[model samples]
Target: MQRYKCTISYDGTLFSGYQVQPQKRTVQSEIEEALKKLHKGSPIRITASGRTDAGVHARGQVIHFDSPLHIPEDKWVNALHSLLPDDIAVKKVEKAAPDFHARFDATGKEYRYFVRLSNYKDPFTRHYQFQYGYPLDIKQMKAAADYLVGTHDFTSFCSAKTEVEDRVRTILRVGIEMSREQLMFRFVGDGFLYNMVRILVGTLLETGRGLHQPEDMKTILAGKDRSLAGKTAAAHGLYLWEVFY
Candidate 1:
Protein backbone atom coordinates (compact mmCIF):
# COMPACT_ATOMS: atom_id res chain seq x y z
CA MET A 1 0.00 0.00 0.00
CA GLN A 2 1.06 3.59 -0.64
CA ARG A 3 0.16 6.69 1.30
CA TYR A 4 -1.25 9.68 -0.61
CA LYS A 5 -1.79 13.24 0.59
CA CYS A 6 -4.50 15.47 -0.86
CA THR A 7 -5.40 19.12 -0.54
CA ILE A 8 -9.10 19.96 -0.73
CA SER A 9 -11.55 22.84 -0.31
CA TYR A 10 -15.18 22.69 0.76
CA ASP A 11 -18.25 24.86 1.24
CA GLY A 12 -19.61 23.96 4.69
CA THR A 13 -23.13 25.33 4.37
CA LEU A 14 -25.10 22.05 4.14
CA PHE A 15 -23.08 19.57 6.19
CA SER A 16 -23.27 18.66 9.85
CA GLY A 17 -19.50 18.99 10.37
CA TYR A 18 -16.17 17.45 9.35
CA GLN A 19 -16.25 14.28 11.41
CA VAL A 20 -18.58 11.35 10.72
CA GLN A 21 -21.68 10.78 12.85
CA PRO A 22 -24.43 8.15 12.83
CA GLN A 23 -27.31 9.05 10.44
CA LYS A 24 -25.81 12.46 9.76
CA ARG A 25 -24.37 13.86 6.56
CA THR A 26 -20.80 15.02 7.16
CA VAL A 27 -17.71 15.90 5.12
CA GLN A 28 -15.79 12.80 6.24
CA SER A 29 -18.71 10.51 5.46
CA GLU A 30 -19.05 12.01 1.99
CA ILE A 31 -15.32 11.61 1.22
CA GLU A 32 -15.18 8.08 2.63
CA GLU A 33 -18.20 7.15 0.56
CA ALA A 34 -16.39 8.35 -2.55
CA LEU A 35 -13.37 6.29 -1.54
CA LYS A 36 -15.52 3.20 -0.97
CA LYS A 37 -16.93 3.57 -4.43
CA LEU A 38 -13.46 3.96 -5.88
CA HIS A 39 -12.24 0.80 -4.16
CA LYS A 40 -15.27 -1.23 -5.30
CA GLY A 41 -16.41 -2.43 -1.85
CA SER A 42 -13.13 -2.16 0.06
CA PRO A 43 -13.07 0.36 2.93
CA ILE A 44 -10.43 3.11 2.98
CA ARG A 45 -10.02 5.35 5.96
CA ILE A 46 -8.54 8.86 5.64
CA THR A 47 -6.91 11.07 8.27
CA ALA A 48 -7.35 14.84 8.18
CA SER A 49 -5.13 17.53 9.66
CA GLY A 50 -7.98 18.53 11.97
CA ARG A 51 -11.76 18.86 12.24
CA THR A 52 -13.84 21.94 11.58
CA ASP A 53 -17.13 22.74 13.29
CA ALA A 54 -20.41 22.93 11.41
CA GLY A 55 -20.65 25.86 8.97
CA VAL A 56 -16.89 26.36 9.14
CA HIS A 57 -15.35 26.27 5.66
CA ALA A 58 -11.85 25.28 4.46
CA ARG A 59 -9.67 26.57 1.64
CA GLY A 60 -6.61 24.33 2.08
CA GLN A 61 -7.59 21.33 4.19
CA VAL A 62 -5.20 18.39 4.00
CA ILE A 63 -5.77 14.65 4.39
CA HIS A 64 -3.85 11.42 3.93
CA PHE A 65 -5.00 7.89 3.06
CA ASP A 66 -3.45 4.55 2.19
CA SER A 67 -4.36 2.95 -1.12
CA PRO A 68 -3.18 -0.10 -3.08
CA LEU A 69 -3.99 1.33 -6.47
CA HIS A 70 -1.21 2.44 -8.81
CA ILE A 71 -2.92 5.60 -10.04
CA PRO A 72 -0.75 8.59 -10.90
CA GLU A 73 -0.90 11.77 -8.82
CA ASP A 74 -2.90 13.82 -11.36
CA LYS A 75 -5.37 10.99 -11.99
CA TRP A 76 -6.01 10.68 -8.26
CA VAL A 77 -7.24 14.26 -8.19
CA ASN A 78 -9.44 13.75 -11.23
CA ALA A 79 -10.88 10.50 -9.87
CA LEU A 80 -11.78 12.00 -6.52
CA HIS A 81 -13.23 15.12 -8.12
CA SER A 82 -15.59 13.03 -10.21
CA LEU A 83 -16.73 11.09 -7.15
CA LEU A 84 -17.06 13.85 -4.52
CA PRO A 85 -20.08 16.11 -4.13
CA ASP A 86 -20.23 19.56 -5.71
CA ASP A 87 -19.54 21.26 -2.40
CA ILE A 88 -16.19 19.45 -2.00
CA ALA A 89 -13.34 19.82 -4.49
CA VAL A 90 -10.03 17.98 -4.53
CA LYS A 91 -7.32 20.44 -5.50
CA LYS A 92 -4.14 18.36 -5.56
CA VAL A 93 -2.88 14.88 -4.71
CA GLU A 94 0.62 13.53 -4.24
CA LYS A 95 2.37 10.49 -2.90
CA ALA A 96 3.47 10.74 0.70
CA ALA A 97 5.86 8.78 2.91
CA PRO A 98 4.40 5.56 4.25
CA ASP A 99 4.61 6.70 7.88
CA PHE A 100 3.43 10.27 7.40
CA HIS A 101 0.27 11.23 9.28
CA ALA A 102 -1.87 14.22 8.34
CA ARG A 103 -2.64 15.32 11.89
CA PHE A 104 0.33 14.20 13.95
CA ASP A 105 2.86 15.41 11.41
CA ALA A 106 1.44 18.89 11.07
CA THR A 107 3.72 21.66 12.41
CA GLY A 108 1.33 24.61 12.27
CA LYS A 109 -2.00 25.87 10.90
CA GLU A 110 -3.47 29.16 9.68
CA TYR A 111 -7.09 30.21 10.20
CA ARG A 112 -8.91 33.25 8.85
CA TYR A 113 -12.18 34.93 9.84
CA PHE A 114 -14.14 37.41 7.76
CA VAL A 115 -16.43 40.18 8.98
CA ARG A 116 -18.55 42.40 6.83
CA LEU A 117 -18.47 46.05 7.90
CA SER A 118 -21.33 47.37 5.80
CA ASN A 119 -24.98 48.04 6.70
CA TYR A 120 -26.25 46.75 3.36
CA LYS A 121 -25.72 43.00 3.35
CA ASP A 122 -24.97 41.20 0.10
CA PRO A 123 -27.11 38.14 -0.36
CA PHE A 124 -24.26 36.17 -1.85
CA THR A 125 -21.87 36.80 1.04
CA ARG A 126 -24.38 36.59 3.90
CA HIS A 127 -23.74 32.87 4.28
CA TYR A 128 -19.98 33.32 4.22
CA GLN A 129 -19.15 36.45 6.23
CA PHE A 130 -20.30 37.72 9.61
CA GLN A 131 -22.21 41.01 9.36
CA TYR A 132 -21.29 43.54 12.04
CA GLY A 133 -22.48 47.07 11.25
CA TYR A 134 -21.01 48.72 14.32
CA PRO A 135 -17.85 50.69 13.92
CA LEU A 136 -14.71 48.91 15.25
CA ASP A 137 -11.61 50.66 16.46
CA ILE A 138 -8.98 48.85 14.38
CA LYS A 139 -6.10 50.22 16.37
CA GLN A 140 -7.51 48.91 19.61
CA MET A 141 -8.11 45.48 18.13
CA LYS A 142 -4.56 45.31 16.82
CA ALA A 143 -3.17 46.27 20.18
CA ALA A 144 -5.22 43.59 21.93
CA ALA A 145 -4.10 40.95 19.44
CA ASP A 146 -0.46 41.76 20.16
CA TYR A 147 -0.83 40.43 23.69
CA LEU A 148 -1.92 37.01 22.34
CA VAL A 149 1.10 36.36 20.12
CA GLY A 150 3.64 34.00 21.80
CA THR A 151 3.64 30.85 23.87
CA HIS A 152 1.07 30.85 26.65
CA ASP A 153 -1.67 28.89 28.35
CA PHE A 154 -4.91 29.61 26.46
CA THR A 155 -7.49 28.16 28.82
CA SER A 156 -9.38 31.47 28.84
CA PHE A 157 -9.85 31.44 25.07
CA CYS A 158 -10.90 27.82 24.70
CA SER A 159 -14.21 26.07 25.19
CA ALA A 160 -15.03 24.64 28.59
CA LYS A 161 -15.75 21.32 26.90
CA THR A 162 -12.15 20.86 25.80
CA GLU A 163 -10.85 17.65 27.37
CA VAL A 164 -7.14 18.20 26.87
CA GLU A 165 -5.19 18.95 30.03
CA ASP A 166 -2.42 20.84 28.20
CA ARG A 167 -3.87 24.21 27.42
CA VAL A 168 -0.55 25.71 26.37
CA ARG A 169 0.05 26.65 22.71
CA THR A 170 2.29 28.95 20.70
CA ILE A 171 0.84 31.64 18.47
CA LEU A 172 3.19 32.71 15.70
CA ARG A 173 1.26 35.73 14.47
CA VAL A 174 -2.05 37.59 14.42
CA GLY A 175 -3.01 39.93 11.61
CA ILE A 176 -5.98 42.28 11.24
CA GLU A 177 -6.49 43.62 7.75
CA MET A 178 -9.29 45.56 6.07
CA SER A 179 -10.13 45.67 2.38
CA ARG A 180 -13.04 47.90 1.41
CA GLU A 181 -16.00 46.79 3.56
CA GLN A 182 -14.49 43.46 4.50
CA LEU A 183 -12.30 42.85 7.54
CA MET A 184 -10.09 39.78 7.79
CA PHE A 185 -8.52 38.33 10.93
CA ARG A 186 -5.64 35.92 10.42
CA PHE A 187 -4.10 33.64 13.05
CA VAL A 188 -1.12 31.31 12.69
CA GLY A 189 -0.34 28.98 15.55
CA ASP A 190 1.29 25.70 16.50
CA GLY A 191 -2.10 24.36 17.55
CA PHE A 192 -5.46 25.52 18.91
CA LEU A 193 -7.87 24.17 21.51
CA TYR A 194 -11.58 23.75 20.93
CA ASN A 195 -13.27 27.07 19.95
CA MET A 196 -10.05 28.97 20.68
CA VAL A 197 -10.00 30.99 17.44
CA ARG A 198 -13.68 31.94 17.68
CA ILE A 199 -13.32 33.00 21.28
CA LEU A 200 -10.24 35.06 20.51
CA VAL A 201 -12.03 36.81 17.66
CA GLY A 202 -15.01 37.56 19.85
CA THR A 203 -12.80 39.10 22.51
CA LEU A 204 -10.98 41.23 19.96
CA LEU A 205 -14.27 42.51 18.53
CA GLU A 206 -15.40 43.42 22.03
CA THR A 207 -12.17 45.30 22.59
CA GLY A 208 -12.72 47.22 19.34
CA ARG A 209 -16.11 48.39 20.67
CA GLY A 210 -14.47 49.66 23.87
CA LEU A 211 -16.03 46.95 26.03
CA HIS A 212 -12.53 46.20 27.38
CA GLN A 213 -9.26 48.02 27.35
CA PRO A 214 -6.56 46.81 24.96
CA GLU A 215 -4.50 45.60 27.93
CA ASP A 216 -7.41 43.56 29.24
CA MET A 217 -6.29 40.68 27.03
CA LYS A 218 -3.30 40.20 29.29
CA THR A 219 -5.52 39.96 32.35
CA ILE A 220 -7.85 37.50 30.66
CA LEU A 221 -4.93 35.29 29.69
CA ALA A 222 -3.35 35.44 33.10
CA GLY A 223 -6.66 34.67 34.82
CA LYS A 224 -7.17 31.40 32.86
CA ASP A 225 -10.97 31.60 32.97
CA ARG A 226 -13.14 30.81 29.96
CA SER A 227 -16.06 32.94 31.20
CA LEU A 228 -13.89 36.03 31.14
CA ALA A 229 -13.67 35.95 27.34
CA GLY A 230 -16.32 37.29 24.98
CA LYS A 231 -18.94 35.22 23.19
CA THR A 232 -17.83 32.74 20.54
CA ALA A 233 -17.89 34.13 17.02
CA ALA A 234 -20.16 32.56 14.40
CA ALA A 235 -18.59 29.50 12.75
CA HIS A 236 -19.63 30.49 9.21
CA GLY A 237 -17.23 33.43 9.23
CA LEU A 238 -14.20 31.19 9.95
CA TYR A 239 -12.10 29.23 7.47
CA LEU A 240 -9.28 26.72 7.91
CA TRP A 241 -6.81 28.41 5.59
CA GLU A 242 -3.82 26.03 5.52
CA VAL A 243 -1.84 23.33 7.28
CA PHE A 244 1.94 23.17 7.33
CA TYR A 245 3.84 19.96 7.74
Candidate 2:
Protein backbone atom coordinates (compact mmCIF):
# COMPACT_ATOMS: atom_id res chain seq x y z
CA MET A 1 0.00 0.00 0.00
CA GLN A 2 1.11 3.56 -0.67
CA ARG A 3 0.14 6.72 1.24
CA TYR A 4 -0.75 9.81 -0.75
CA LYS A 5 -1.19 13.36 0.47
CA CYS A 6 -3.38 15.73 -1.48
CA THR A 7 -3.87 19.48 -1.34
CA ILE A 8 -7.54 20.22 -1.92
CA SER A 9 -9.82 23.19 -2.42
CA TYR A 10 -13.58 23.11 -2.05
CA ASP A 11 -16.59 25.44 -2.19
CA GLY A 12 -18.50 24.77 1.00
CA THR A 13 -21.83 25.95 -0.34
CA LEU A 14 -24.50 23.24 -0.88
CA PHE A 15 -22.62 20.80 1.34
CA SER A 16 -22.98 19.88 5.00
CA GLY A 17 -19.29 20.22 5.92
CA TYR A 18 -15.93 18.47 5.40
CA GLN A 19 -16.55 15.41 7.55
CA VAL A 20 -18.78 12.50 6.69
CA GLN A 21 -22.32 12.32 8.11
CA PRO A 22 -25.10 9.85 7.66
CA GLN A 23 -27.35 10.67 4.68
CA LYS A 24 -25.71 14.03 4.03
CA ARG A 25 -23.33 15.29 1.36
CA THR A 26 -19.91 16.47 2.53
CA VAL A 27 -16.44 17.20 1.16
CA GLN A 28 -14.89 14.10 2.73
CA SER A 29 -17.77 11.90 1.59
CA GLU A 30 -17.49 13.19 -1.95
CA ILE A 31 -13.76 12.56 -2.11
CA GLU A 32 -14.11 9.16 -0.49
CA GLU A 33 -16.89 8.21 -2.88
CA ALA A 34 -14.71 9.22 -5.81
CA LEU A 35 -11.90 7.11 -4.42
CA LYS A 36 -14.26 4.16 -4.16
CA LYS A 37 -15.13 4.48 -7.83
CA LEU A 38 -11.42 4.52 -8.70
CA HIS A 39 -10.82 1.38 -6.61
CA LYS A 40 -13.54 -0.61 -8.38
CA GLY A 41 -16.23 -0.23 -5.67
CA SER A 42 -13.93 -0.88 -2.71
CA PRO A 43 -14.13 1.68 0.09
CA ILE A 44 -11.16 3.98 0.70
CA ARG A 45 -10.95 6.12 3.81
CA ILE A 46 -9.27 9.51 3.99
CA THR A 47 -8.05 11.66 6.86
CA ALA A 48 -8.18 15.45 6.70
CA SER A 49 -6.02 18.07 8.36
CA GLY A 50 -9.04 19.54 10.12
CA ARG A 51 -12.77 20.07 9.81
CA THR A 52 -14.36 23.25 8.49
CA ASP A 53 -17.83 24.21 9.63
CA ALA A 54 -20.81 24.46 7.28
CA GLY A 55 -20.57 27.39 4.85
CA VAL A 56 -16.88 27.79 5.66
CA HIS A 57 -14.75 27.42 2.56
CA ALA A 58 -11.15 26.16 2.17
CA ARG A 59 -8.42 26.95 -0.33
CA GLY A 60 -5.60 24.71 0.92
CA GLN A 61 -7.13 21.89 2.87
CA VAL A 62 -4.93 18.77 3.04
CA ILE A 63 -5.76 15.08 3.32
CA HIS A 64 -3.92 11.78 3.36
CA PHE A 65 -5.17 8.42 2.22
CA ASP A 66 -3.62 4.98 1.86
CA SER A 67 -4.40 3.16 -1.34
CA PRO A 68 -3.64 -0.36 -2.47
CA LEU A 69 -3.89 0.66 -6.11
CA HIS A 70 -0.66 1.80 -7.70
CA ILE A 71 -1.54 4.98 -9.55
CA PRO A 72 1.23 7.35 -10.65
CA GLU A 73 1.71 10.49 -8.51
CA ASP A 74 1.06 13.00 -11.32
CA LYS A 75 -2.05 11.20 -12.49
CA TRP A 76 -3.63 11.09 -9.02
CA VAL A 77 -4.49 14.80 -9.15
CA ASN A 78 -6.21 14.61 -12.52
CA ALA A 79 -7.96 11.35 -11.69
CA LEU A 80 -9.39 12.71 -8.44
CA HIS A 81 -10.33 16.03 -10.00
CA SER A 82 -12.25 14.24 -12.73
CA LEU A 83 -14.12 12.16 -10.18
CA LEU A 84 -14.87 15.04 -7.76
CA PRO A 85 -17.73 17.45 -8.27
CA ASP A 86 -17.20 20.84 -9.88
CA ASP A 87 -17.02 22.50 -6.46
CA ILE A 88 -14.23 20.27 -5.23
CA ALA A 89 -10.76 20.04 -6.73
CA VAL A 90 -7.67 18.07 -5.83
CA LYS A 91 -4.99 20.57 -6.65
CA LYS A 92 -2.00 18.31 -6.10
CA VAL A 93 -1.23 14.79 -5.01
CA GLU A 94 2.08 13.03 -4.23
CA LYS A 95 3.37 9.97 -2.51
CA ALA A 96 3.65 10.57 1.22
CA ALA A 97 5.67 9.02 3.97
CA PRO A 98 3.87 6.24 5.74
CA ASP A 99 3.68 8.19 9.02
CA PHE A 100 2.71 11.56 7.57
CA HIS A 101 -0.60 12.16 9.31
CA ALA A 102 -2.34 15.32 8.01
CA ARG A 103 -3.90 16.55 11.24
CA PHE A 104 -1.39 15.44 13.82
CA ASP A 105 1.60 16.65 11.82
CA ALA A 106 0.24 20.10 11.07
CA THR A 107 2.30 22.88 12.65
CA GLY A 108 0.06 25.86 12.04
CA LYS A 109 -2.96 27.13 10.13
CA GLU A 110 -4.19 30.42 8.73
CA TYR A 111 -7.84 31.53 8.49
CA ARG A 112 -9.19 34.57 6.69
CA TYR A 113 -12.40 36.48 7.31
CA PHE A 114 -13.74 38.87 4.71
CA VAL A 115 -16.14 41.75 5.27
CA ARG A 116 -17.95 44.05 2.89
CA LEU A 117 -18.17 47.66 4.02
CA SER A 118 -21.19 49.08 2.29
CA ASN A 119 -24.89 49.84 2.80
CA TYR A 120 -25.89 48.32 -0.53
CA LYS A 121 -24.99 44.63 -0.46
CA ASP A 122 -23.61 43.31 -3.73
CA PRO A 123 -25.31 40.08 -4.74
CA PHE A 124 -22.12 38.78 -6.29
CA THR A 125 -20.19 38.86 -2.99
CA ARG A 126 -23.04 38.15 -0.59
CA HIS A 127 -22.16 34.50 -0.04
CA TYR A 128 -18.44 35.22 0.25
CA GLN A 129 -18.30 38.08 2.72
CA PHE A 130 -19.97 39.52 5.77
CA GLN A 131 -21.82 42.77 4.97
CA TYR A 132 -21.51 45.22 7.83
CA GLY A 133 -22.58 48.67 6.73
CA TYR A 134 -20.45 51.10 8.68
CA PRO A 135 -17.02 52.57 8.99
CA LEU A 136 -14.75 50.46 11.17
CA ASP A 137 -11.89 51.96 13.12
CA ILE A 138 -9.08 50.00 11.58
CA LYS A 139 -6.42 51.46 13.86
CA GLN A 140 -8.36 50.47 16.96
CA MET A 141 -8.94 46.96 15.67
CA LYS A 142 -5.24 46.55 15.00
CA ALA A 143 -4.39 47.60 18.50
CA ALA A 144 -6.89 45.10 19.89
CA ALA A 145 -5.50 42.35 17.69
CA ASP A 146 -1.96 43.10 18.83
CA TYR A 147 -2.82 41.97 22.33
CA LEU A 148 -3.78 38.55 21.00
CA VAL A 149 -0.46 37.82 19.32
CA GLY A 150 1.83 35.29 21.07
CA THR A 151 1.29 32.43 23.48
CA HIS A 152 -1.62 32.72 25.84
CA ASP A 153 -4.59 30.92 27.30
CA PHE A 154 -7.40 31.77 24.88
CA THR A 155 -10.34 30.57 26.89
CA SER A 156 -12.16 33.85 26.34
CA PHE A 157 -11.92 33.57 22.58
CA CYS A 158 -12.75 29.86 22.44
CA SER A 159 -16.30 28.57 22.49
CA ALA A 160 -17.50 27.72 25.97
CA LYS A 161 -19.14 24.50 24.79
CA THR A 162 -15.83 22.97 23.72
CA GLU A 163 -14.56 20.14 25.89
CA VAL A 164 -10.91 20.72 24.96
CA GLU A 165 -9.15 21.43 28.26
CA ASP A 166 -6.05 23.08 26.90
CA ARG A 167 -6.84 26.57 25.70
CA VAL A 168 -3.25 27.69 25.50
CA ARG A 169 -2.15 28.25 21.92
CA THR A 170 0.34 30.43 20.09
CA ILE A 171 -0.87 33.01 17.62
CA LEU A 172 1.83 33.82 15.08
CA ARG A 173 0.09 36.93 13.80
CA VAL A 174 -3.14 38.81 13.07
CA GLY A 175 -3.38 41.00 9.98
CA ILE A 176 -6.01 43.20 8.38
CA GLU A 177 -6.11 44.58 4.87
CA MET A 178 -8.72 46.38 2.79
CA SER A 179 -9.33 46.06 -0.92
CA ARG A 180 -11.80 47.77 -3.28
CA GLU A 181 -14.83 47.41 -1.00
CA GLN A 182 -13.76 44.56 1.22
CA LEU A 183 -11.82 44.27 4.46
CA MET A 184 -9.87 41.07 5.08
CA PHE A 185 -8.53 39.76 8.35
CA ARG A 186 -5.89 37.01 8.39
CA PHE A 187 -5.20 34.95 11.47
CA VAL A 188 -2.12 32.67 11.56
CA GLY A 189 -1.88 30.53 14.64
CA ASP A 190 -0.25 27.36 15.85
CA GLY A 191 -3.67 26.02 16.72
CA PHE A 192 -7.20 27.23 17.45
CA LEU A 193 -10.03 26.02 19.62
CA TYR A 194 -13.64 25.71 18.50
CA ASN A 195 -14.92 29.02 17.06
CA MET A 196 -11.80 30.79 18.28
CA VAL A 197 -11.14 32.80 15.12
CA ARG A 198 -14.78 33.90 14.78
CA ILE A 199 -14.96 34.95 18.43
CA LEU A 200 -11.74 36.92 18.13
CA VAL A 201 -12.98 38.65 14.98
CA GLY A 202 -16.29 39.51 16.63
CA THR A 203 -14.47 41.08 19.57
CA LEU A 204 -12.23 43.08 17.26
CA LEU A 205 -15.27 44.28 15.28
CA GLU A 206 -16.83 45.41 18.53
CA THR A 207 -13.68 47.35 19.31
CA GLY A 208 -13.64 48.87 15.85
CA ARG A 209 -17.27 49.93 16.21
CA GLY A 210 -16.54 51.78 19.47
CA LEU A 211 -18.51 49.21 21.51
CA HIS A 212 -15.28 48.38 23.31
CA GLN A 213 -11.97 50.16 23.66
CA PRO A 214 -8.83 48.68 22.17
CA GLU A 215 -7.11 48.45 25.51
CA ASP A 216 -9.99 46.32 26.72
CA MET A 217 -8.44 43.44 24.82
CA LYS A 218 -5.75 43.16 27.45
CA THR A 219 -8.34 42.92 30.18
CA ILE A 220 -10.35 40.35 28.27
CA LEU A 221 -7.29 38.22 27.73
CA ALA A 222 -6.30 38.48 31.34
CA GLY A 223 -9.78 37.72 32.59
CA LYS A 224 -9.98 34.51 30.52
CA ASP A 225 -13.77 34.59 30.68
CA ARG A 226 -15.88 33.70 27.67
CA SER A 227 -18.85 35.81 28.73
CA LEU A 228 -16.75 38.96 28.65
CA ALA A 229 -15.82 38.50 24.97
CA GLY A 230 -17.89 39.49 21.97
CA LYS A 231 -20.36 37.35 20.04
CA THR A 232 -19.30 34.72 17.52
CA ALA A 233 -19.08 35.99 13.96
CA ALA A 234 -20.94 34.21 11.18
CA ALA A 235 -19.14 31.23 9.63
CA HIS A 236 -20.03 32.23 6.06
CA GLY A 237 -17.42 34.99 6.12
CA LEU A 238 -14.55 32.74 7.18
CA TYR A 239 -12.15 30.68 5.07
CA LEU A 240 -9.51 28.19 6.00
CA TRP A 241 -6.84 29.78 3.89
CA GLU A 242 -3.94 27.40 4.43
CA VAL A 243 -2.22 24.94 6.71
CA PHE A 244 1.51 25.04 7.47
CA TYR A 245 3.60 22.03 8.32
| Cα-based lDDT for every prediction | 0.95, 0.91
lDDT of 1: 0.95
Per-prediction tally of clashes = 0, 0
- Per-residue CA lDDT of candidate 1, range 1-245, in tens? 99999999999888898999999889999999999999997999989999999999999999999999999999998899889999999999999999999999999999999999889869999879988887999999999999999999999999999999999999999999999999999999999999999999999999999998889999999999999999999999999999999
Question: Candidate 2: minimum summed lDDT over ten consecutive residues — where?
Answer: 126-135
lDDT, candidate 1, at 90: 94
Off by over 4 Å in 1: none
| Per-candidate alpha-carbon RMSD to the true structure | 0.7, 1.0
TM-score of model 1 vs. true structure? 0.99
Clashing pairs in 1: none
Point out where model 2 deviates above 4 Å.
none
What's the residue-level lDDT of 114 in candidate 2? 92
Candidate 1 lDDT for residue 31: 95
